[model samples]
Structures are given as structure tokens and as C-alpha cells.
Target chain A: MTASRENSSSFRNHTLTVLAIVLLFLFLWWADGSMAEDLGLSFLPEGLNGYEVQILNLVAVYGILAISLNIIYGFTGMFSLGHAGFMAIGAYVSALCVLTPDQKEMMWIIDEILPSLAALHTPFWFSVILGGLVATVFALLIGIPVLRLGGDYLGIATLGFSEIIRVLIVNATPITNGSLGIKGIPCHTDLFTSFIWLLVVVFCTVRLLSSNFGNVLKAVRDDEIAAQVMGINVFHTKLFSFCLGAFLAGVGGALLGNLLTTIDPKMFTFLLTYNILMIVVAGGLGSISGSIIGSVIITVLLEWLRVVEEPLNLGFVEIPGIPGMRMVVFSVCLLVIILYRREGIMGMREITWDGIAAFLSRFGRKKENRA
Target chain B: MSLELFLQHFFNALTLGSLYGLIAIGYTMVYGILRLINFAHGDILMLGAYFVFYGTTLFCLPWPVAVVVAILGSAGLGVLMDKIAYRPLRDAPRISALISAIAVSFFLESLAVVVFTGLPRPVHQPEWLVSIITIGGARLMPLTLLVPGVTAILVAALLYVVYHTKPGLAMQAISKDIETTRMLGVSVDKIIALAFAIGSALAAASGIMWALRYPQINPYMGVFPGFKAFIAAVFGGIGSIQGAVIGGLMLGFIEIMAVAFFPELSGYRDAFAFILLVVVLLVKPTGLFGEKQKEKI
Candidate 1:
């Protein structure tokens, strides 16, 4: 096809993709538990129960988070373990914003709510954006000093930062309610908003990666020395990637808090970061599609894995559920992946139709050869 | 604070700092040889504590015997962690090894939860160590002074081994240049394992002392000390043993002193270590005793 024709066709494809997503939202919204039951469409996949819907919300939140981490660690080659910290900032910011004064009054049992904070409130959208912006601000401050360090030093430093953030949140009783975390924050996130946020983040990330800036980021990741030799201003590029990732992570955290309708210091810890890292590494470090796909698999798997924590039965005997078995299994799986298959599911490759066709053709060829 | 109070805090700082220094050595030694953070080091320290917990309670072994057994078990575990988790990733990307270390850390933590249960159990503090002694109008347990003294002696013995032994020389040579040392007919893997063994033993010792001081044992107890010790290692210069100990002691003093000076900010005690680490890393990334590293083109 000619260049203009190709552009027009691509634009049409984009429109179709977006419209398809919108249709999905409309269907989901219309077919929610009550609606579907009334309409006699309760058995349909779209008529998800509360728990199933939660998994979807978690997928979207984690999809966004995994993408952010993928960009930082996969595309830009920065090993950051601060997503949990950023998410906590976002979660606290958004929760505090959306909560009414009465709710704040009820929740702050440890100390009286600050008068100014009690008065301050914002729409969910505005509050979420503010959370992202605030987290970005933190990332900017932290990145300026820390982006200079390389490898594990940067890793440890970022980990330290997240711990520090948690510590601050725990100690700053007036602001974060100290260890007695906020409760009963109004639920603001649903499938529609979360998916929209994920789409926007993924779209922006994809566009950014395809641009000149993305190339510079990959260059810096592959070899900082070579990128610097080519005059690519490595520090600024790294700082940009770090800040962007933090901003998205912050947004994800906000959505998570709203979805859970609760916020606490204990919730955002290394394990939270570890969950996102597992998704990122499992999906493929540098691929956006990989993150989404990985998010779906890992989220569903996490929910499914909860079965191990419940009582089990055999023909002859019953065994009590193991409390921490899920984490053990998850860690072992990750270890096997890291040890045996370091590239993960997608590696550096994206899921293209052409690639899919090629994979199928190879499968067909193998079948024919076997015959 | 009164003079007696100040002295008591000083002893507290010394004991805590020595324990931190002990754990920090594990991190520094591992980093010096592998250039890997051994994220599992803290978890290994946790395992060491758990081992002691079980040895005394499960087997009814004497405290000293249990301690020795726990240290040995930790050493074995450290070496096994290397052989299994890290060995295959020798040629892989450095981050792969790091992620594996992370996996092992959580695996041990969750495993502890599974085996030892998630609840925090009180450690068995021997009567001799728990006994109070008065010094300069400051009353403290015998364990306080014993902890630092024991740590000092272990560190000195470690220094002598690292400087005088053939295996220690091999470890130093490998850290400088793994390939060159390999070419020089050194058993690099064995030496690396040896380093892990020693580091893990020290971590276990630190864990035991920490348990005695706090009189509590839990799966997650190692996480904070592990982090602070790593910070200490970095502060002292990541690859330098002496630097790690000094860094550990300094960190302990800073944390205790800062809390003592401002009781209101005691809740932010953990933040002090992270902030100190960030500042030290920014000022001199190589740390106090670390040699300057030049980036190669």
C-alpha cells in the first residue's frame, strides 16, 4: 500500500480498536450482576460476580503497574523496586482526597484529622491525577540524585527510598494517620475507568517507545556508554523514564485503594512490589503487550492459587490448608523462570499479527514434518 | 538525658551496631566477590534465627550448642543458595541473579511461615546473658557487653582468615578479577562458596544476638536488620569488610542516638538508615573504605 493509504488504514484500525473497547465497557456496565440477572443473561461471561470483577480491576491496575515497571527496567534498564512506594503515595493521596470530612473524622481514631486536610476534597478523576502528579514529583526529587547510580546500587537505593516512604507514612500520624491506616474510603474505581486508564497509559507508553526518545531510552539501556558516546544525554533520559514509571505506578496505586475501599501502611510493602516485579519479569521485561498478557495470567493465577489456602480432601483423608503456600508456589515458579527461562514469555518481542501467523505456520510445518 | 542514661544508650548502640556490623559483613563479603546484593542474605539471617529457635525449643539443645548448630546450618544454607540459585546465572545478566536472590528471600520467608508458623515466638534468653550488671550507675544485661565483645572477636578472627589463609587470598583475587583468578589455577566457585559460608555464619550469629536482645523471633524479623546491614555495607564501602563493620556500628549509633536525642521521632527510626544510605551513596558511591571505581568506555 502507498504511505498515505497505509496511514489512513492504520487510523481506521485504531478507531476500530478503540470502539471495540468502548463497546466492551458498555456491555460490562449494562450486564453487571443485577442487570444481567434481570435480563436473564446472568450465565454469560460478561455477567461477572463481585470477585470476578475484582480480578478484572486488579488486572487493569497491575497491567498499568507492570507496564510502568517494564519501561523502567525493561526498556530503560533501570532496576527499580519503588513502585510500591509510589503506589502508596498515590493511594494515600487519592484516598485522602476522595474521602469526605465525616469519613475522615470517623477514621482518624488515633489522632484528630488535620483541619485543612478535612476540608480538602476533590473529584475522583482530579484526585487520581493529583496522585499521579504528586508521585511524579517524588520520583523527580528522588531520581535527580539516584539515577546516577548503576545496577544493584540503584536497586538498593530505590528499595531504601520505598522503605523510607513507608516509614514516613507510618510516622507522620497527622498526615497519613500513622500506622492506623485510613479505612472506608469510597470505592471509585470500576472496570470502565480502570480499563480506560490502562489503555491511556499503554497508548502513551507505546507512542513514547516508538518515538526518538524511546530509541534513546533503549540505547541507554543496552549500553549507557555507547549511548553517551552518541551524545544521548543519558541521565535526563533515565530521569524521564523513572518519573513516568512512578507517575503511572502512582495512578495504579490510587485505583487499587479506591477499588479496595481501604488504605493502610502495611498493604504497600516489598511483597506488593514483588508481585508487580513478578508480572513484569514473567511478561517480558521490555514489551507492553507482554505486561498486559502477564497481568491477566498472574492476576487470575493469584486468585486461583488461593485454592491452596483452603481445606483439601482426598479419598481417605483431609488435609488442612497451608497459609503461605501460595507465596511459596509463586516464588518457586518465578525462580524456575529466572533460572531456566530468563527471557520470559515475550522477551523483547511484541505480539504482532504477522508474528502470530509465522508462529502458526511453523507449528503447521512441524506437524507436516512429523507426518 | 542523664550521664547514666547516655552511657546506657551508648552500650545499646554498641551492641546493636556490632550486630549490624556482623550482618553487614555477610553483605559486603558477598558483594565483594559476586557483585550481587544477595537479597536473600537477610532472609538467610532469618533462617538462622529460626534454626536457633527450633534447635532450642524442638530439640531441647543447650543455648550454646544450638547457636553453633544454627551458625553451621546458616553457612550450609548460604553455600547451597549459591550453588542452586546463583551458580547457573553466572553467565546470565546480573539482574537475573538479583531476581533469583529475591525469589530465594521470599521463598525462605514464606517457608518459615509454613514451618515455624507466622506468629512471633519469644526467644529463649539464657539466664547468664539476661542477668543485670551495674556499670557507672548504669544497669544493663550481661548480654549487652557480651554481644559487642563476641562480635569483635569473631570479626578479628574473620580478618585474620581473610588476610592469612590461602582460600581468603583466593577470594580476594577472585573479587579483583574472577577470570584472572580462574586462570591462575584458583578454585573460584569453591572460594565463592567459602565466602558465602563465612558471611552466612556471621549473619546467623548476628541473628542470635539480635534475638537475645529483643527476646522475640519471627519470620519477618530479619528484613529490617538485613536492610540496615546492607546499608551499612554500602556506607562502609560495599566490598570492604572493615568498612561494613564500621558502617554497621556507625548506623547503629546514629539510629540510637537520633532516637534518644529526639524521642518524639522514634517512630521514624527506620527512615534514618535509608536516608543515611541515600546521602552516603550520593556523596561517595564507593563508600568510606571502598576503592574508587572508574567507569570503562
Candidate 2:
């Protein structure tokens, strides 16, 4: 009887959680459309430009990317600097797949379009999934050879792969449009779409992390040899984590490309990967919620930090913007974080409901005492 | 290839190899002691070049004096970077140091961008180094000969210091076992600083030579060469100095010869070194000259 009661309560809790999330999402969807004034007041302030909204969307995308990276680098103990490359594959593939033939014709002015790819077109959702799949395939191919090498060697090899991928994208003129890049990708990404994708990705990641496979992954991360002795196939587990990370990275890339309405070889440089690395490291390596929080903080701060990179005007004085100052500040922050707060803001802990409830109760007791 | 073309490619490869080798020594030396890839080593090379540029133009120093200034400045910066960015993290996880190194790299590059502006400054070549010299049927610049000659001397000097000197023995011991070296009476920090100083001095020499060869200086210029030199160092063996030179030379030859033979593949030239790196990692992770040590389980 107690078991049945516990099961029903658990079901009720799940339903309540789902209802709360759905309500939140519904509010966002409505605010995004007809309730622009309300959104401007509550979600974002009035007088904010389109660029701010775009930055907000990027935070969602980066959240998903960071969590995915956490699976490989955090949970699986593989240091990969190739997230940008996978994202590039996703970006290029999705962009190419979704662009109209007319748009392709306009964009590929530097070289003739490959006849096979010219006529190809898929819907936005399909293109995104296809991009993820393509990235997964590439990850598998690259992973087979380089995954055995641990630590810094893996980092360099993956970095090399990303560079090679970038080179290929630049040189394969017929397919990627060379340096001109593809423009006019349909903008299908927005707050709601990206939030939904982030939810799905985070849900999947959480489920995967809680599963037996996730345990195996953490085992390998803590000690590969010990995990192997415990009968885990270390290689296969790592490969799985890598492919999953690549898949989500691809999806994030697709969202970024569609939102920006352009895809370019230059967009997927090591600098892009570096930014993601900063997010992962700052978010606390192994925490899922930390990834989300880190993504939001870093992405917004990066955009906000543009103030330093732009000229400031006062009533009586003007201070010219110093280029690269934004990055200088960012690197300093990263250095500080690495040196002092290496475990990051969240460490390996997640934000739990019980912790929140206990804090609320404690606040209520404090008010009672004051009274 | 004709004899003239062959010789031309050979000399070009030698010059390129020497620069790569010189830069790789910095990487290998740091990696040897710390097991950390000094990503900022490339930016140090850039700073070295910039130091020389300013010394000559802004300060009106002679070229030789400017070179000395560049080397000293680079060495000081290298030691400072170690003390500030890396020394604190000596007891931290290796990944932290790697990240710190990357941060240093970004910091230096961004600092350069702010101070030097984004424009690529034209390096004024000393007239003595710019004159074309002929060897048999091949024509070359005198700097080409000087680069390899300087590289050889530097490598020999480095080898002597590493093998015959007391600090050199300390470096070898630290690389083998850091804690044990610390347990011994050696000042680990000083030895590490010395490694940084020597490595940066070599990097400065290469950077000056590279500027002489290329004649243009930009804040972001050292990135590609730095990566390629790291690849060269790895190909030779991370801890082996001689291996770095051989690997640098081989990479230089492959890069030049591949482009020379098939001009169309020039677009893929940058990819070549990375491909070589991946292959080397896969086939021989220890590299050609690297001694394989059993992992202490």
C-alpha cells in the first residue's frame, strides 16, 4: 500500500513538473508572437534591439552545445577541441540542405555548384537532423583513429581534425561555395524553437547520464583502466559519448546557421571552439545544469562585453573603443576561473528541488523569528 | 624536377625547416619539463618579431642590437608568462595548465591587436640580409643561408646546454619526475624559468628570421607557423630536441615539395601538416625520436 502511494505521489510530481514547464514554454511562445509588449517588459526590457534577441537565442543554442560537450569531456574524460568542426559540418550541411536552388545559385558565384547537391533540398527540421547525423558520422570516422590517445594528444589530434575540416570546407569550392559561403538560409531558429531543442537535448542527456551507460562513462572518466577491469568496453563507451556530443553540436550549429541566415568556412574556426571551451570549463565540467547556467552567463556577458569594444560617449568626453579589449577581459576571466575557482560555480552538483524547498522553508522560519 | 628547381626547393625547404625547428625547440623544451604545450610560444614569436620591428623603427637601434633586444625581450616575457600564468598552476591538473597556456596565447594575441592595431606592418629587411646569392645553378637570398646556419648553431648550443650543463640535468630530471626533482635540492621554479628563457630566445631568433623571409608582420601571424612547428615537434618527438629539427625539416620538405610538384594541391597545403600529425599519432604515438615510457599504472 505504501509502495502504491509512493508511486502515485511520484507520478503526481512528474505531472506537476511537466505542467509547469509546459506553462512556461506556452508563455514564451505567446510572448514571442502576440505579446511583444509584455515580453519587452518581463522577459526583456523595452528599447532592446533585434541583436539582443539574437544573443538570447544564441544562449539557448550554446546551452545545448555545452551540455553535449559535457558528456564527452566531463562525463567520458575525453578532451575534444573539435566541437566547432562538427558544428561546421552541421551548419554547412543543414544550410545547403535547406537553401532554395535559386539561393544556392546566387551564393555559389565563385564556382559552379555540384550538380548532385544543387537540386537537393529538405525541410528545416529534416535538414537539422540530417546535419546532426552527418556530424555523428564524421565524429565516428575521426574518433576511430584518435580516441585511443588520451589527454593532450587527443586535444591536438581533434584540433587537427577541426583544422582539416575547415580547410576542406574552404577548398571544396563546388560544394561549400568556397570562401563566399552560403547566404539566405531560411531563419527557422527563434526562442521557442531553440528552447524546445534545448529541452529535448537536455532531457536526452540527463536520461543518458542516469542510465547504466552513463555510469560506465563516468567509470571510464574516473579511471579508464579500472573501468576496463570492471568489464566496460572503454573504447566503445568513449566513442558513443563523442558521437553524442558531435550530434548535439551539429544541431546547435544548424540553429546558429539558420538564425544567422548565413554559413561560412571562417565561422567555424578554433576561436569558436575556444569560446565553447570557456563555457564548458566555467560551467563546472561535469554538471548538466551548470552547463545551462554557464552558457547563459557567458553568452550574455560576451555580448554585453561588446560595450568595451565599442566607443563610449559621455556628455563631455569620448573614449574610443579598443578592439580586442573584449577578448582581453574574457581571457583574464578564464585565467582567474582556472586558477581560483577551478571547480567553477556549480562544481559537480546540480540544482535540486529539495535544496530549493529547504531554502524557502528556512527563509520562512527567518521571517517568523523576526516577527 | 630540374637540378636548379630541385636545389631551389631544397634551399627553400631548409630555410623553412630551420624556422619551424627553431620554434619547435621552444615547444619541446617546455613540454619536456612541464608536459604542457605552450600555446603562447607562437605569440611569443610574434612579440619577438614586433620587438625587433619597434627597436629598429621606433628606437632607431641597429639591426644586430635590435635582434639582441628582441631575444632578451622575448626571454623576459616567456619567464614572466611562466611565473604569472603557469607557476601558480604547477600543482593543479595538467588540463588547467593547458588551458592557462591557451589563455596566455589569447591574451598575447589580443594585447598585440590592441597595441599594434590590426594592420600588417611591413618589416624592413636589412640590406645585407636581402641580397640574392647564387649557389651553382640556384639563386637564393643570403637570409636563407643565414637562417639554417643560425638554426644549426642554436641547436648545437641547445644540445650542449641540455646535455653538459647542470640546469640541463635538472630539466631532464624534472621531466622524468617533477616531485622527485623537487624533493632533491633543486629550485624547480628557477629551472622552469630557465627553460622558458632559453626556449623564448630560440623562438625570438626564428621569429626575426621569419620576418626577414616574409617581410610582413601582423599580430595574428604566428598562429599558423606555431601550430605547424608544434606538429613538427610532435613528429620528431616532444621531448627530443634533435627529433624536433628532423621533424621540422621533413615537414618543411613535404610541404614545399608537395606544392612544388602539384601546384593545384596548394590550397590543401595547411591541411598537410595536420594530416601528418594525425597519422603520426595513430601510427607512432611516441613519435620517431620519442622514447616510449611505460605508463605507471
Q: What digit string (tens of lDDT, one per residue) describes model 1 on residues A29-53?
A: 7645555666677565556768888
Which DockQ value does candidate 2 get? Answer: 0.84
Deviation from native of the Cα of residue B273 in model 1, angstroms:
0.7
Per-residue lDDT of candidate 2, residues A1-371 (tens digit) = 99997788668657766996899676565646546565454564233357766877888899988987888898898989899999999999999999888888778887999988999999999999999999999999999999999998898889989999999999999999988888888899977888889888988888888898889999999999999999999999999899999999999899899989988889998888888889988999899989999999999888889999899999699999988899889988888899889888898887755566568899999999999
- Best model per lDDT: 1
TM-score of each: 0.96, 0.96
lDDT of 2 by residue, B84-138 (tens): 9999999888888998888888889888998998799999987888788889889
- State the DockQ of every prediction: 0.90, 0.84
TM-score of 1: 0.96
Model 1 docking grade: high
- DockQ of predicted candidate 1: 0.90
Which residue pairs of candidate 1 clash? none
